[model samples]
Each structure stands twice: as structure tokens, then as C-alpha cells.
Target: MAALITRTRARWFAVAAAAVTLPRAAALTARASALTRRSMLLGAGTGALAAATSAAPALARPAPSDGAWAKHDGAFAGVEFDGFKKTPSGLEYKVFEEGYGVKPTAGQGIKAHYAGYLLDGAKFDSSYDRRSPLGFAVGTGRVIKGWDEALLDMRVGEKRVLKIPAALAYGKRGVGPIPADSTLVFFVELVAITG
Candidate 1:
């Protein structure tokens, strides 16, 4: 009887030991899994942050071909006519009468009233109704070459119609309400020149 009791006690102790160890092992495994999951999430978040930081400059940079220019005189050039006054640099415009103008210098700002339409007379953009001049920068590739040339010779209070070639306008990627590579016609009024 004594030997049997000793054996039974030993078996119970072994069973109790196993039960306690099993819970401890389970807790350790849960902790490890949680740590692993946290590490993965942190790594993914860091990678995303790095990618965005690296790409910011590229996103801010403007494209060279953003604004189209007409091919004239064997160069991607533009022409100016009557009502168009050329500046001393022969690359700028200061209008003294009613006519069209283009903005030059890849990044000068312009304040003008404008009426834009398709060559077929389909109207697209207009600022006259707002009784406000539209402000835009030159060559920062906002406007095409034709517009740059046209604005160069225009002055405050000058208005004119402009015929823009496809090469100097939207090119293949036309903007809202404008077709790709379609010639544009604009009636421009120079209200101010702050750039």
C-alpha cells in the first residue's frame, strides 16, 4: 500500500508539472507571435515612408515637354505680328493695343483675361464672366510656346485673338474640355503683368 501511494503521488506531480509547463509555453508562443507581427507592420510602414520621401522631388518636377511649341523658321519658334510689341530681348512682348499675347520666360507669372475655344469655335475656358484676369506663370510649362510668344508683346489692357498650333498647345495630352493635338484659339486680354 505504501509503494502504490508513492507511485500515485509521483504520477500526479508529473501531470501537474506538465499542465503548468504547457500554459507557460503557450504564453511564450503568443508573445513571440505578437512581436513578429509588430515587427512586420513597422517594417512595412517604414518602407512606405521611405518611398514617398524619395519620390517627392520627382513629383514636383515639371516636364520639359509640358507646354507645346510650334515649329516655325526651322525651330520650335513662334511669330508675332501687328499689335504685338517685342521687348529689347526680342523674346518678350509688351502690348500697346488690342490683340493677342503670349507669356515667355519659362516661369513668369501673367494676369490676363482669356477666352479659349477649339479651332472649330467650340468654347472651352473663359474668365470674362468672372470679371477677373487669369493669372499664370510663363514657361514653368503652364502655357504652350504660342501663348508665351503672344503674351510677350502684349501690354496692360490689350486684347487680341490667338491661333495656337497643336505643337504649342496641348500636344497629345489635351486638358479638360480640350482635345489632344487640336489647334486652339484664344481671345486674350492682358490685365496685368506681375511676373
Candidate 2:
């Protein structure tokens, strides 16, 4: 089941990097400095994932360089996934049937609140207690690739469930309470978007 869901998500990951990168070059014209830092952070995260892989022998494995099936199967690769629909902007997402909002975008700076949980349904991080929006640039690498992808096709006032595979997430050595090679789930709300 998890494998299926991960394969589903991996299918979207390829399109995600392209989708966000295309819009970013032009959009960052006015905010070059901030965008640069965000890009650095993202690069750092990617580097971290690579480094994490070498840390634990239990987590050591080659990743799929192409296709969602291969990516998920090797990394997070199996299980059927449901719930989100693909949009023209390249985001596959669903609004909570009981609530409302729009998809997110890469260039839009967002003020959001979120909670991160492991596949076993254990919560790792939450913004509710902080009573504040966690500000971040959507696709510039300020956050994990899963988040960068999930939040890119949204509009203001949107909420999303970001189902993340281990590759787009912590990869091998999971951060803090998250386990090595863990899959993550996030409930995120875009409270506001600012220039």
C-alpha cells in the first residue's frame, strides 16, 4: 500500500522540479538575494540527503534516476495512491473535501502552518503550537523537495496534504524523531502569500 502511494507521488516529482524551476528564473528578478539564499538551502538539503545515505548501512541503497516506478520501488516505490488530482500547473493535489482553498506556486512567498508525521501516524513537527505561520519561499529550496513541489501550484488561501516519499523527504537518515528511510505526511495550509 505504501509502495503504491509512493510510486504515485514519485510520478509527480519529476514534473515538479521542472515546473517550479521554469517560473523561478523570471520571478526572482526583484528578489534575487532572497531567492539565492533559498536556492542554497535547497541545495544544502539535497546534499544532506546524499550525505545521509552514507551514514547508516541499513539505509544504504541506490536511487532510481528516472521514472516514478523505479524511484519509488527503490526509494519509496509501491502502493496505490488516491485523493489528489493533477493540475495544469503540474501539481497533483486535493483540497480537504470538507474545506476550501487553491493550489500553491513556486514564486509565491507563503505564510503557512503545518504538521509533519511519519507513516505510522506519529507527529514530528507542528506549527499550531507556535501560533504563527512558517514563512517560506515555495520552490526555491527553502524547504524539502516534497514541500517545494506540493506548494508550487497553489494560490492564496489554500490547504494541502503533501504525501512525501523518502527521497523527496529525509531520504536515508531521517531527521530528529523520524526514522531512517522514512516516508512523511504533511498537513499544510497557506495562510497568506506575500511578494
Candidate 3:
């Protein structure tokens, strides 16, 4: 499944306008940045990190071939993942649109949009409402565990439904709008990968 890249692929496609180069003098500050190498190293972080690999691994199971559903089917707020695939770390995802574009590697910057919901169908957050994608370094703990694990397997422009277990999410110490131990659901689309 391959085709020429199109501008209409995802919401709005845009890569970094310019490659950022941090001055050597900022090395120490960079080391102290939120994504420190010592803290991140990925797999060393948790079971979720075990999902990261050099190449995308085969999905344990794939969703229905039909791929005929909208993001608001309300299936995301439930625990059932009838046609989803499971990663080694317990993250469940259904890839509705395969982008066949460049897949992000560890430490690479990614731009993605997401709509987050709770198991009870309560809405929490969404990048769509913001009209801008979220940016972060994949597999570097800059985001939640499930996100870090899933993004590595996703290619730019791919859209997926993710069922994130509590362990791979905020866990017992849930953040605002999310109850403790609450599993999360998200309709995520990879917009771009840069740096």
C-alpha cells in the first residue's frame, strides 16, 4: 500500500521549517532538559517501552478490513477492542488509515492530533479543537507511556484508535480531568515527523 504523498493526507501537513541546531554552549542545559538521556533510554523506563523497535513490528491482530467508521463511534470510551491489535506492552490500537509514510524513530520529533476520552465516554482533551497538533519527541517519555509506544509503530499521516490501559497512562496518580486508574481512549493521527 503505497502512493505519492499528497497535501490532503492528514489534517494539514507541515514539517519543520528549518532544522534547529542548539549551540554547543547549551550542551549542559540540553542535558538538563525535560527529555534527559539518563531518564529516557526508553525500554529501561517500563514494560511499555519494550514495544519500541528498530523497525515496525507486525501487529498482533488487525482491525476489520472495511475501515468504514468515524472517530465519534463512541467505541473508544469502552474497554472492548474487538478488532484492535495489541502491542507487547498492553497498548491496544486499531489502524484505520495506513499512511505508508515515514515512521518515526526514537528521539525524533512528531506532530500529531488526538482526541482523548475516558472509559465512561467523558471527553477530556483534543488537539482538533486546538486546531494545532501536539509536538513531542517520540519514545522519550515526553508524553504518556502508551503514546510513546504507539507512535514508534505509526507512520506519518496514519490514523488510529488507541485504548490506553491505566498502567500505560497516568496510572494511579491521574492528572486533571482523568480519574486515577482510568484507562484512556484516543483518536490519534500522525501529522508529521521531523528532526
Cα displacement (Å) at residue 96, model 1: 10
- Model 1 lDDT per residue over 38-128, tens place: 2222243334433433433221221111011111122111333333333333332222123223434446677777767674556777676
What would the TM-scores of all predictions be? 0.45, 0.51, 0.62
Clashing pairs in 3: none
Cα deviation of 3 in candidate 1 (Å)?
Answer: 99
Runs of candidate 3 exceeding 4 Å displacement? 1-80
What's the CA RMSD of model 2 in angstroms? 21.5
Q: Write the per-residue lDDT of candidate 2 for residues 1-195, one digit (tens) a residue.
A: 999999988987766555544244333322322222222222333344334333323311222111111111112112323535554433344442112345556676777777676756567787765666688778898888778876665555445556677778778976889888876766666667664
TM-score of 3: 0.62
- What C-alpha lDDT does candidate 3 achieve relative to the native structure? 0.64
Q: Which stretches of candidate 2 lie over 4 Å from their true place?
A: 1-81, 85-93, 97-107
Q: What is the C-alpha RMSD of each candidate to the true structure, in Å?
A: 28.5, 21.5, 17.9
Cα-based lDDT for every prediction: 0.52, 0.53, 0.64
What is the descending TM-score order? 3, 2, 1
Q: In model 1, which regions exceed 4 Å deviation?
A: 1-107
